[model samples]
Target: MDETKIAQLRNQSIPPARHFIDGAQVSASDGGTMPVTSPIDGAELTTLARGTHKDADRAIAAARGAFDDGRWSGLAPAARKKILLAWASLIEAHALELAVLGVRDNGTEIGMAFKAEPLSAAGTIRFYAEACDKIFGEIAPTSPGALGLVHKQPVGVVGAIVPWNFPLMIGAWKLAPALAAGCTMVMKPAETASLSLLRLAELGHEAGLPAGVFNVITGEGPVVGAALAQSHDVDALVFTGSGATGRKLMEAAARSNLKRVYLELGGKSPNIVFADAPDLNEAAKVSAAGIFRNSGQVCIAGSRLLVERSIYDSFLEKFAAQAKAMRVGDPLDPATHAGAINSESQLARNLAFVDAARAAGRRVVTGGTRILEQTGGTYMAPTIVADVTQDDPIVQNEVFGPVATVQPFDTEAEAIALANGTTLGLAAGVWTRDLSRAHRMVARLRAGVVHVNTYGGADITVPMGGMKQSGNGHDKSLHAFEKYLDLKTAWIKL
Candidate 1:
């Protein structure tokens, strides 16, 4: 960016951010704050209030009060729908600021964040808002003299914890439906990328949402997050992150209120290419997108590539060249396609996985080392590894980076076996022109979403989530509404 633009952005003096609770921004109880550093050039962006257990308690109490008081929950579905649509409009109005905030805070590519993340978040809110008044409860006749009515109602207080990669987008996946269903929520966005959501909570209030209907607490998981999970008042907990943390949250929920726990965890999804695939170059490009896009921070990234033996060597060559060509630089650069790994720890973890893969005797096809060392930013070139086996740790584990492992299979059966080798069944991609083969692969693959030609092309209308260790509960579409709602069947005897 030009110096003049940079100066203007810096002079914009965004108010010092704090926790949004009970419809207001408040300081942490202990006056504690955590330094939020920019991953772009390692600049200190700002300091955020470090919420503690007390903050969580206050937020939950506010949510509980709002729900019990029927201030938000008592509103008609049409009213909530109107309020949520206004919230979406507010997000769209502030898209540029929110996108820039995400870029500075999370180190995502500015262009991608500017158009994709914030805009998509606004669209999501709008989509779910449209569903509010359309939700239908069913009525059925009993065998004899009774009638059964299935009434769908909110799950009460929902505690949502979204990750850092696409905080605005994924946060919408949780918040929109919860709000539309008349469930008040206390959300804890990943501390690494909490700014936009805090700003979002402020927008919620601006959109005329009731006080305490939506709240945000900023801190690490152990303190504020665990407080939400362990709170007896929180009716349900929704999370999207690593499985290890998900287990802890589940245990906390089980130990306390036994609240309904919904999780969307990690994945090692497969991108299978057959010999008869139309346009090998296109397939190769999408395969690159499955991992290279967002620096492979996506949970359902197709990190494992299973190519037919006939196309194995050829596909690897094309994929490696594409991976090697990905531009890595400053996040704010519009031309830059790849940016810094979100954090130092994440960069370390990504590099460690490469080191382990090398030690395990896998041949590195392209990138395996860090780049842009002088900028003080955490940057890495897209990496591709050949000779990956079904049992390789890189294939079995979720390497949430720009790392793709290629393996060759003999037949359709072999491809299916290799793709389904891991415990994760979040997503997979099949590249073949044969209609029968596509259908066959789709049916056999144990994934929640199977892409026929494209690797990752989805919208807010389509339900997204995973099977097996990738965690349960859908995140998008009308199905996601079910997670935040409970069904009550009333039997009327005549």
Candidate 2:
């Protein structure tokens, strides 16, 4: 991570991206391509193949052929584990290169992307690799003359669509488990962030993954994503994106072969602070970091903050100070605390939320404007809007940027109501020294993951998902295996 080396990698030339289908890099069938512009400096980074339904069909056929022929699915569990471990090691070896490439592609700060993108992906692959051999079938008790057995098997070809934010990390969450469970895969990374994943699949092949066992197709979601969702050859579909897209994928599944679709969608998570919190300063720091890190592109970010009326003013001061003190600059710069927003359109969307709140007579407490326009990169100052009501659009919608809404509540009951007011519940946080209240909040908050006295930093050991409009299905744990696997029952008579 030397400053000079970082610059060198940043300036390194990245080749045009191509689809990795059937174990070989190929162009779109129609020779179509799309320009990929860097959000860091507004430079054209590279071009990606503009894949169409034909490309999707080609990849699907490859995966289907590989699975039906048992090239990957028929492998011994230990053998699959060995190859996957090799893939993880290769990923670790190129961790820095991959991290820098991802930053250049998606504008995530190197400090965060280095760990969150490549290193985290390496660990996830390693985790699932080690678990493949350990997974077991079951036996069921029956009458004396009868014997019953239960078996767990790979669900066959998997189709995954991951978003631009943290592509490598989220891609592995789907790829590793499916591959380890003996399923072949065809993945489509977001149009804006397909380079890292294309490179990742190449590494997988280099680590001895069989041809067609893992394929990646890059293109517009409407074409590639729809093709995958509706492909009857695909046994299941996994996605991590917005709620509207999730609903569309579900509908496509129903209209097709009823392919099981697993979605990890958006969130408007709440972070509540009680007067008797352990340390108000620490809570403020963590809460600010939770929402603002990665330019608040995190799906589980604590976007809505609720504080007790008694300590509301003091806590808001600390939180706003934290947001203001963060350095927003080039993602490649190690000194930067926050990076560029992913794209110009996304930055405009974030600012619109702030503008609407300002016009609605809400207090723009701190940092709610665009900055660094001279650099030609899309950047937004971390924004905090205080005195926000439950009905505020900023409070209800998922901005997916470094924007947060603050509100004060008089009692724990009111705090709970405000926290749970949104239809989306992916994650929540409670800061309090009262153990009883902590447990009660955990029980009542309708979120998949609730952080007590902490925010964010939930490792891959637990499940991460959402309830309500936030979408369904879990990611990041052994629980994730449930989606890629199928259970079968066998009855025997003596």
Candidate 3:
């Protein structure tokens, strides 16, 4: 990490961004543009083509045509694998540029953004690239000298809606596997974080992805996202965003061609700490990082802290100290532990949660106020609210900020109940050295991923999905390929 180079990149001018549709940079049909403001400071970095339903239709038509003609879909699996690997390599080659661009766009700390965005995207692409060629169709068991074949075919065209917090990373989570499986795609990057992914689309084209094989449409979610969801030509839709938007996509699918929908909606995940645990200090540190990292913009962030009553006071002390110690400032600065909030609106929302907690007489354990406003960027102190019940709105809802709520539970059953009390069950953390209790908690927790001693850092080898309102269908791992593939059975008479 060269600080000088990062600083230079941070100051460099960005080119005008446009939608990458049909292998070319294009403007919206209506010639509209949206100003892209960098949350690193209150500065307009660039302008992007403001897409609409017509633009989406054009992109989808291109994808439909490409899929139908087999320009990409007709290629051999190894050929597709080669191109995808090339794309991944291109991403790695431009990792720093993309990371800086993303941080400037979304205000994630550069230290975290480098790995979380571009490098993570590259790794994801490579993971699916390696797996695509190895999957085999099955030969079904049959009677009387008859052979039955089961084929795995690519679902035609895929539509993806990715969020702002980790645009490139989450975009690749949908893009890589679908491309690996030979599905053409049209994507709508979140309005706030479109630059990196638009650049990613260009790299994909440079790596020899055919026109319409992978397209990006940039604009507001309601117009562009809704178009992608409702397009009858789109065979499946995958999204990583809020639950409200997820429901709209589902409704659009139902009204149109009934495209398969896979959603990774945000969660209010809980992190539990017990008395007889491993190092409480380390648990407290990891738990704080789990939520506070990326400014708690992660979909599966540990926003709820459930501490055992026996060690409640002590654990709260450690946690609040950790929160207060985090340096929240310019994202480009390497010394900063946490970066700016993604936008002014999000900062306001986070503070509202804190103010409500205070109004209700909850103890503001550490931080609850906006900070570094003199710098003209959106930043907030990492907040912890103690003495709150599960019924508190701050505890129940996904604040999607650096705000965390702490509650105490006396018994193991009570801890499990409180952890599972939220409707959103995306991820959870259980810190305990007791092997039997760890196993029991893992079994009992309703989340998609449960960490026994760790809070975050689950790798791509495992599936990440949600249960209940958190939405369905897994991302990462081999299971992700299933969403892009369709199984067909062949019956023959002998």
Q: Report how far off residue 124 is in candidate 2 (Å).
A: 0.4
Structure candidate 2, residue pairs in collision: none
Each model's TM-score, in the order given?
0.97, 0.99, 0.99
- Tens-place lDDT digits, model 1, residues 1-494: 34355335533655567999999999999999998877887877888899999999999999999999999889999899999999999999888778878878898887678766779989998998889999889988677788899999999999999999999999999999999999999999888899999999999899999999999999988998899999999999999999899999999999998999999988899999999999999998888978997888988888999889987888889898788878888877778888778988888888888889899999998888888888877888899888977777877888898899888999999889888888888999999999999999999998989999898888888899888898889999999998988999999997
| lDDT tens digits, residue span 62-179, model 2 | 9999999999999999999999999999999998889888888888988999999999999999999999999999888788897788899999999999999999999999999999
Model number with the top lDDT: 2
Tell me how far candidate 3 lies from the true structure as C-alpha RMSD in angstroms.
Answer: 0.8
Better of 1 and 2 by TM-score: 2
For model 3, the local distance difference test gives 0.92
Q: What is the lDDT of every predicted structure here?
A: 0.89, 0.94, 0.92
Looking at model 2, how many pairs of residues clash? 0
Better of 1 and 3 by lDDT: 3
**lDDT for 289 (candidate 2):** 94
